[model samples]
Target: MPRIALIGGNARPITTAHELGVDVVLVHEEGRYEPDFADYCSRILHAPIGDSAAILEVLRPLHAEQPFDAVLSATEYAAIAAGEVADALGVPGTTARTARALKDKAETRRLLDEHDLSPIRHAMVASEQETADFAESVGGRIVVKPADGVASLHVHVVESREDAATAFKQLREAGYTRAIAEEYLEGPVVSVDTFSHRGRHVVFGMSEYQMNDRFVEWEVSTPSRVAAPHRAELTELVGRLLDVVGLTDGPAHSEFVLTPTGPKVLESHDRFAGSGAPELVRRACGVDLYRMFLAVQLGFEELPQTSPVNDHGAAIRFFTPQPGTLKEITGLDTVDALVLTVPPGEAKGNIVPLLSRTREAEVVVVITRHPGDTLPELRSVKDCSSGYVIATGKDADEATAICERVVDQICFHVE
Candidate 1:
């Protein structure tokens, strides 16, 4: 039997790995790891709490004993660490340089600027005055975020000096020492997932991104219903970006904005697509991205055969109900794909509001076989459809209309 060792196994990708029939050897502590499905392997390894050197030390003995056939890093930090270990262990993986470029927002933007890919007007600010000045110099309105953070933590859209000050203060309170402010691009956002092996990159699928506020991503749907012209343009642009970035192996997930000027790259991840993206893509397309990555790590010369498995699109929407004691949920039976981040009866701390807050109460996802299914059909029937809905359409107008319907559904309830 082939054995695969996975670091950062505390994430969504671990579930994907389990779904793909790969035995998972979790590196994190037993209590911290959670899987939605049954695991084939009951093995557990304690992970280093803070230091990378400590993690390496813990893994050194495991590598000698189990002698894994492949190793996968689930998180950005782990990916960077895994790169070095892969080289030492002669296991195939991403380079530390590539992982760094993708993980650090400041470095990512700088590299993109240097490549003349998308000229992002941005600055690294450590103080309120510097943030205000940077925003003013970049024309006042800007998007501010942490250089190395995930889940849209401490992200803000500053419209003026005052807004920048508030955003800076919030970042400081959140323990962020530095943040990057860039000219906010006004347009719809989309995410693309790809797989690269032996210098060849294959585009798996593209999905539309729905944001709750400035930083929280609420939904992702595959086969984004985008205008034909824009879709063609984006496809071409993404292909070129993969070449430019030299993404030669493993998986890549990139986000871009479809602006009037054209498609601009927002960010990219040099790992398996996050969230339930791998599963969503697999449902839409026959590709099992996790298994493909596993094959890549094992040095398989030929890639797996992947094509659209279903004619219809699939989408997922995350929700955060009014942050309070979990009373009850009323709409799970009505939805096709639903995952509650916080179970019922859980006290959700004061979540940020949609306009200013970055988190939600829960997440609801919908999958449909019909291309014409509107967002209204996907909306939760409870509370008169007041909660947020994220839908994926076969093509752009469908996606846009679905998003509009989701926005409309969210307005049914007002605090």
Candidate 2:
């Protein structure tokens, strides 16, 4: 059996690893690890997943007892630790340098600029005036965001020096000293989700996003219509990107903006696409990325020489309910799907588990916030965690319509 060490993710990968007949050890922080995961793994190890030394300290002894075939992670930050652990233990996985280059937007920007891959004007800034200077140089709209931030938090779009200064002040107050200011990108955003083996890249699904002003994706669909004409270019670009970053295995979710000029990279990750995107790929391309994450690592599955064809269209939509204390949520029973509801103000660890389990249900309704919970204003993905709907259709449009129709049937009564 291929013994694998999985760091800091939900239960999907754990369950999949078990099904692969691999002996898996799950590493996560205390209280955060799912209780149900015990059934799938032989041991559940706890660690501060983001800390490389801490993870190494825990896994080193276990690795010495019996060497691991691979080290992995499904989370964003923990992937770096996984890489570092893999290197330290002399296991096969992404290198720390590659993971860092991919995770840090500033590093990615600099690397891409050096290679002249996906060109976008960007600068790392330390002061408000420096940010304003970049904005002034752009002479139009610009986006200021944390160099290593996730979930669209603290990302500010500004066209004026005053707005830039205001955004810088907010970021500084938020304890983000390392920020990047870049010229704003326009056009539809899409992800060219790929799986690679030994540096061979295969495009699995080109999922497109529909976003709110905050840049949080309200909905995403597979087999990108907007990026249809640019599939070849995108595939090549992602291949170049993964090659540049030294990502030789697992999934790559490379997001891009289809500008009038051409496709420009928004960002990319060294793990599965977030927010139920792997599910979107399965529904559309008939490819299971979660399965591939384990299967490819152990060399049980061969890398498809060609990109998997999308047989159908699929989409996922999130619930951005009114921002207030919840009074009542009604109309859920009308939808023919698995509807999970918690107290309005209760804890919601909703997204990851629901994304993988909403199988066979044409529509899935997940409500993370229950009655009396305060729905803070949707400033970032963090605030818009009330719930979401994932659906499928004959095409992206159809799948999106299915999600929309389901959302319509469910009503949130927030005060």
Candidate 3:
């Protein structure tokens, strides 16, 4: 069997690779080991966190001993490492330039603007003053975020210089010295999942998001209700954006907001969509995106034609609670039967630790909340999530109804 070097274990890419009769060698950061991977992974390699040099040192010997067919990563943070390893080994995968652009928001925006694919104005600012100036220049309202982040962490919407200054300060204090101030574009957010082989684009799915006040996604529904024409337009636009960013092979996630003018690219990454989206796509299209990504990288020329597996809708709703001491929760049995559910992935406890206090904490609170726990102080997504509710229905409305039913039936009591 051919071997693939997987750079992260955050998703079920290992299981997918294994099921496809491919061997996955799991490489992850030290102290972040996942025992679940042992069953599917052939070997486990570790390197210092955020140290690509150390990761390369680790992969070199492994490659020499047993040549890898491809280097793969399904996580945003590890995409660059995957690219570097692939380049060194002359394998099929993302290029170093594309991976770097995906990791740096400032670079992505600049590239998009240069290509005339993105109309929004943005700047990478170092200090609160610079952020304030950019906000003023962009008509007072701006979006501020760390130059490097994932899953909406440390992102802020600012309407005034004060908001910009405050957001910039919080970002710096959080150890991110550089931040991007962007023109706040308003619209519904959606994710476009695409596959490319040597620059040939194939768009398979688009998922719509319901976001909270802080712009954190609260719920996600796949096979977006976007009209056919608009969907086609979005498909064309995203394909061009991928080419602009130089994505040559494998899977990529590109998020966009449909503005009054048209669909504008928000951000793009070379990975499968996070937040339970793989299951969503599977429920909608019957496509194992993780597996397909690996197969394409391993040089599969003709893939199985993809189409909707069902007309029914699939949705994921997060369980977010107010800040208070945990008391009890109910409705597990009732909520569990609603649909195929991926459990809200944490254990319940007496006092849920608040993850962070920044603006991100508000959305992050709900982002991380579990289904059946009491959170005394809801801080960030990391500490407050109790669980998530996944549902499938005959249509989008029906799917939403199932999710809503889960919400209505499940109860969290805190004091």
Give the per-residue lDDT of model 3 (tens digit) for 1-415. Answer: 9898888645367766777789888888654544466888888888753556777788888889998888777777788877877888887668778999988888898888888886788988888888888888877578888877875778888877778778877887889988888888877888888877767787777888877676667678877886244787887888888898899787888988888888888999988776667766766666767767777667654554443444556776766666676566666555445222223443222012121111121111122343344464333344325556666666666776677777777677767
Best by lDDT: 2
Q: In candidate 1, which residue ranges exceed 4 Å CA deviation?
A: 10-24, 35-38, 48-50, 243-246, 299-301, 304-310, 331-415
Worst window of 10 by summed lDDT in candidate 3: 350-359
In angstroms, the error of model 3 at 277 is 1.0
lDDT of model 2 at residue 308?
Answer: 78
User: Candidate 1, residues 1-415: lDDT per residue as tens digits?
Assistant: 5566677643344554565566666566434444331354546677652234655677678778877666667665577666666666776667667777777888888777777877778889998888888877877578888998765667788887888889989899989989988888878888877787776666777877666654555566777655235766666666666666666787888888888888888888887555456655764665767667765656544665443434546554544444323334444454443323333212111111121111121224321111221223222211112234444456334544554544434322212
**CA lDDT scores, all candidates in order:** 0.60, 0.84, 0.70
lDDT of 1 at 161: 81
- For residue 51, model 2's alpha carbon misses the true position, in angstroms, by 0.7
Cα lDDT of model 2 by residue, 241-341, tens digit: 88887888888889998999989988999988888888888888788889999887788988788887777898888787878888888888677777865
The Cα error of candidate 1 at residue 404, in Å, is 11
